[model samples]
Target: MNNDVVVIGAGPAGMAAAIQASSLGLKALVLDEQPAPGGQRFRAIEQRYRRLRAAGKGLPASEQKGLDLIRRFRESDTRFVDQASVWDISPGGRQISYLHHGRSFTIPANAVVAAPGAYERPVPLEGWHLPGVMSAGAAQTMLKMSGHPVKGRIVLLGCGPLLLLTARQLSNAGANVVGLLQTTGPADFLRATPYLPAALRSATLLKQGLQLLTQTPLVPKVFSLTQASIIGADHVEGVNYRSRGGSGFIECDAVLLHFGVIPNTQLSRLAGVAHDWNEQQECWQPVVDAWQETSAENLMVAGDGGGILGDEAAEMSGRLSILRIAHRLGRISDQSLSKLAAPLQRGLKRLAAARALIDTIFHTPETMLIPSGDTVVCRCEEVTAAEIAAANASGASGLRHLKVQTRVGMGPCRAQMCSMAAMAMITPGIRCGQRPPPPATVRAPIRPLTIGQLAEADVEI
Candidate 1:
């Protein structure tokens, strides 16, 4: 009972989980790599949005929700370790092992919650390695958080709710949104609409998209997106494409391209938790039951790390996980269990409805974003997209063979920069392995420390 209950990530979902655990009178420790908590989402909102909110912070509903989240974490009691990157997780001799502080140690937590949120999945395409192309999520964060807006007349590529919405945000923020690429045709609504019955829970999401399109009718259309390749010698100067109906090039300085996100399951895979391929979402998610318990009873997963359930659902899931943890520890009576679950279950239902609508209009990666014959698939190792094609050309198809043929996945960054590109080259039907980041390779401290600092650290702490 006297062990650290570690929560990875301090994003909205992880924050909610930590607060719930502490409120239940449990000892918990949160580990995050960032100097500040608030994963990328609220972290970005904290920027210009905060200045805008300072005028009438509580007025705008969206900005207000963001503000409230920041205030809550600021007031929580969970112990936080910033700049502490959790590199690996494994079953620790009846406990869980965490590689932190550049050392491997295990904590005996009766419970553990993995709340690692989502990261932008790799966007593979022809000439995607050209300097000017980047994922929409990365561009958004750079502007919102770092105050470095992705400049120039940007061609916002990829199709999904995210792409459209991001275009609006960029346009609002004064970037020239030259083109909004659509991977799916208008017939996509017809082809995928049949899934709507199962997806109607997300009506608010569908409404939101309709509203955005209504507000800004000038969004750019597909600028030669079918099997298109961005062309440039050292930087992306333009995109050339031949759709079924048309062919042309859309010149641009930058291209903000991205599909939907995959689960940030690096730790889950490293921990050897059971995972299954979800073709639809195109990423691995942890296997959890009704209570968010993983295949291993002591381990639990919550939030987008659990799967792509959106933020509100993630908050509710965190609360639900806490309830289950309390119940398992006998902190609550059986009679009270029913009373607790009813409202929580109802809330999840509403979130489910909202999620359905989002799934429909959300971005789906077009073949243009995936690798083609001429593209250099690996950017970090500088493996040309053509070499990957040469391998695939000879029936040396699939990501494994592609990797074997070209040493794309063997660099120091260790596939972090190349795995998704390989997958993008292959068909969706092929199997892919989780490219979990190897433990942080520590280096000498920035400021050369004297024996005095080490001796002082030992003496003081």
Candidate 2:
């Protein structure tokens, strides 16, 4: 199938793009991997959709906007494909390959917007793989979407609004949360404070962190807590942790560990989009202009996939992307769209300023970065911290050396998980005074496509 514009994700950004495109009289099509739209933030929204659908009621305000977008596309003959995983996008001419219902299909669109949001970064603490140990966001998605019961007694670890929000959610969900642990160093926030005046002019959003630190005295606290390991062999019994001045153990069945999020840009790299390394967020995100356009002429990206701006920014980015898309398609002039969106654009600018303010107030610390000195950086090959150390010591420095010597990033993920952590251990210029490993080399099969699926996929599309 072909269309004037194809959005590869059904998240807020893609939905927004689709809406803008449809409104501007362009034929829009949206393809997504999930069974429904809303990306990660609203992935749980399907239950809400079912309930609304059952009641013969339309979507609520937020969801209604999304539904309106989908309906507009459908009504105008624009296409929407769910369970369509666009694994690879061949650049230049038009090409996209996806697997739907175990059958491969391809679509060539005149323009594309990639809104494949970010995912949790798995920082390897000792025994991180033990049951009950999960990313804070993962547990939230599991409980919210699947009704899966998380561990009974939980300790939410990490810094950011996410930890506080997750702790509150789990508490509300009936998990007895002992405490919400914040791992941010005060110095980090201090470093970020200078950026705040610009970030917090209006957004009271992260003000919660500062307020929690003062009031209740129990709700939220910022301190660095290093975990030795999650206790218990089969499951997480508790966590062994060490902090300044003393070491102690927090007895709990589960520990929700979240360092932060990193963009899932495997597909973009495969598509040859340029990416900038956000060292603070510890991930590589696509580089997009103010218009959300990427290096490729016909490609654009938005949201956390572009950078870690969180949920609100995600929705706004998605919406702005479609406005930009309309301009690129020649359906609407840039001046016209910008003038029409002046109010919304000003509001977004204010929010962006506010988010920056709070992120500085509660940013995660660098000290909590991946542990070095014999810590296992890669889990796939059973490679140990000692092996990585040896690789670093043996004149073999940098990620390539670590890979050649320790086989850290050579696993099934081909370095997605381990590369960031490995680089953390091996500081740049440690080897030959050269730059660090360039982003992992990307090729076809961005994600694992079965042989049968590959066979069904035609290159011509």
Candidate 3:
């Protein structure tokens, strides 16, 4: 199985990259873990909408751009393999290994596009491990992928555009949105004003955000919440919080929490690509060159996986990446490549300006740095904040040390859920003013793979 290019992830970026590569007369293969082509943002939109209508629910407005891109990619000569997970990229990144339906196989590629996407930033809190608590992305997945809404009163908690948007979605879906707990305040808005003009370039997005924030029917809107503690034993019965007005409590059947998103860097890191700490976003971003190529030659990281610049930018970045690859492969002239890339680069810059405003406006509240006393920090390992503090007191002053001391990040999810929390606890220079600590170390099998599967893997020369 040799190919001209192999694009990992079938989202906006991967799909675009494969299509563009194929258009340039290169054989491109797209491998994705989803049963369908759309990533989380556009997850199962076409089929799920029909399911929604059959259940007597109105079809939510779909992402037309994503659907159109999917159609074009499907119609192209490129090959797409879904329900496949790439577990490793061999030395020099010229070979790819993946597992599908209990079988493992390997392929050779001239170039690889790693458009692996992003995930919601996890903020652990008291009772966050409760049965009814989930991330805002999870809630939206339920609403979009299935027509499932919260069974009873639901509360939207924390900050970010996703919080407000999910609140509106749930409200519009006829779910009982009991309240909205917002961490960001007017001061944050004032701070973000300088970047507002650039962000407002997309008037449609600006209007949609405003409507979601101001017109959502959720009641008892709580703003500038300093601290939120989920209160329940067997399950979440309500949430308690502190605000300028004093302490408050609200009863709810479920709580959807979000604090923006960070790149899903596990696989990229495992590949030993160079990474740097992004202070503004407070996460490690894979170091990519102007063409979205990483330090590793012929390996590219695009889309939210490179950095969380939104879906449109992801699509543009994908097309730009493969065009560069096409030029490198001598399929296109340098003059033609430059003609194509110049505009995409400028568009990404404008989108970056808009993203600065969004990041500033929805900045992570300081109170969410680490969980409160006794809060569960690692759901996979059932590790608590108190235990982490105990390890810290015993001289666990780094992520690796903390992991060894408390086994917080040595779980099945490979620290995806708790590494950030551990880093926050152990990162030095918090009191003094210095860059945050590096991300947790990533090792291969970036995702869990069975030994039997490894033994059965067939590699084609």
Candidate 4:
């Protein structure tokens, strides 16, 4: 099959890109792994909206916006493939191979938009592998999908706006949110003060943020937490935490951790695009031009997958990415492209300013990034920080070398959960004049695929 554009994801960026492509008379196809569109932010938005409306409850502004976007996407002429696991894209970004409904298929496209979205930063503390431990985002996802809050006593830990927001949402859903432990303290807020002038431009967002902080259910809250460890024998029983004030243990059935989100750069890396380390955000992101075109020709990355710019900016970026594709396809002239993109770029700039403050206020603490001792950095392979340190000490030179020595990034997740932590451990030991270690190489079959599925693939060529 061939398409003018192949969009990988159905989130804000992918849906918006497809909508823009359709508007420009381009043949666009969106491949999303979910059963429906609306990626993570709007996961099950259509279903949830119907349920909430049936119950006569008012939809939150965010959900309403997502519903509007999803509705627009559904009404657009663009094609959508749900439950489509896009396992690989050719290095040049012209060919995409995906598995849908247990059958594999390949599609050729003139341009590809990658908006796989972001994932929570992995924080591997002792006992984090316990059964009841999950990311705050995961809790929100469950609530969004099933319309039920997590059961049992919940202890929300780590930093980020999502942490506060999830706590409030869960509490409102009748979950017992017993404790909120935040790594962000007064020092982080002090650092963020300088960005307030720019952030003030988006007063509505700031107000919503303030409401989250104040409206969260009154619970045992700890700020500026220096360290934390989940305590359990088989399942999560409680969390022990240390902060500027002192130490305490929160007895809870569940521990929800959030250290903010980072770009899901695996596909971009797999596509052989150049990437740069974002020190401020503490993650690797694909190098994209002003129009969201990536280092590789005809390939673009948008949404949080490019970087953590929030959902609204993601929609703008999604639309911006398609403008270049449309121009290249002769659907729009250069002047037309520029005219259409001007407003989106301006909106992105405004959102970026507000993001600067959010990023500063919720910067992941250094201690959490570089775990030591017996902390398991690679949960999939059960690789420990001490083992990684040992490998580095034994002359494991770079990321690939360390992987060879400790099998850290060779797990089923392909280092999605552990690569950043592993990179942090490996970077500091580099000898002078030696080239810095490159990111772990991503290969084909990015997602798990059975041999039967491959054998049954229907090749269009």
RMSD of 3: 2.0
Q: TM per model? A: 0.83, 0.86, 0.95, 0.97
Q: In angstroms, how far off is 6's CA in candidate 3?
A: 0.6
Residues 1-461 of candidate 2: C-alpha lDDT, one tens digit per residue: 45888888877777767766766787777889888777877775657577658989755464465555445544544478899888777864168888888878777767887888887776777767677888888888887686554867787777666666677667655777875666655566677777677766554554655654543224433266644566777988877666553566777888888766778787678788788765445457888876677888878787778877766566677667777767766777768887866765675677766756555555544454656554556878878766776777787666777777878878888787777767766763323343455677767666668988787776544
Which regions in candidate 2 have their CA more than 4 angstroms from the true location? 48-77, 185-189, 204-222, 226-228, 279-282, 341-349, 428-436, 458-461
The lDDT per prediction is 0.66, 0.70, 0.85, 0.88
**Candidate 3, residue 378: lDDT:** 92
Q: Which residue pairs in model 2 clash with each other? A: 13-318, 199-353, 199-354, 199-357, 374-385
Q: CA lDDT of 432 in candidate 4? A: 27
Which candidate, 1 or 3, has the higher TM-score?
3
- What local lDDT does model 3 show for residue 82? 91
For candidate 1, write residues 23-133 as lDDT tens digits.
777667787777676777666555556567677643346555755776676677778777765544555213443334544444555677888888776667777777899
Cα lDDT tens digits, model 3, 156-177, are: 8989888888888788788898
Candidate achieving higher lDDT, 3 or 4: 4
What lDDT score is found at residue 174 in candidate 3? Answer: 88
By lDDT, the best candidate is: 4
